[model samples]
Target: MAVDLGQFDHPSWLTVAGTGLGYALILAVLTLTMFIVPWLVFSAL
Candidate 1:
């Protein structure tokens, strides 16, 4: 199940910039959590 966003192009640079930052932030958080949880549990004695 998915909702289509239609077009991928933006009308201006501001929108593109904002979206790029938002995507990066989301990716960073997901990646950090994915690795951190395992490391934390494995290292804890």
Candidate 2:
């Protein structure tokens, strides 16, 4: 007899990878604008 698994469908790998990349992009943008740019401006003064 064959063993049976659950019937629920899982998410695709592409969807998971795309979501991770999008999150990283947003984090990088926020870090650059919020911290790096201001630091550079003030340090130059």
Clash count per candidate: 0, 0
User: Over 4 Å off in model 1, which ranges?
Assistant: 1-11
Worst 10 residues of 1 by lDDT: 4-13
Q: What lDDT does candidate 1 reach at residue 45? A: 56
The number of residue pairs in model 1 that clash at the backbone is 0
lDDT of prediction 2: 0.86
- Highest lDDT: which candidate? 2
* lDDT tens readout by residue for model 2, 2-34: 755543334666678889999999999999999
Name the TM-score of candidate 1: 0.61
How many angstroms is residue 26 displaced in model 2 relative to the true structure, after the best TM-score fit? 0.2
Q: How far out, in Å, is residue 13 in model 1?
A: 0.4
- Report lDDT (CA) for all predictions: 0.83, 0.86
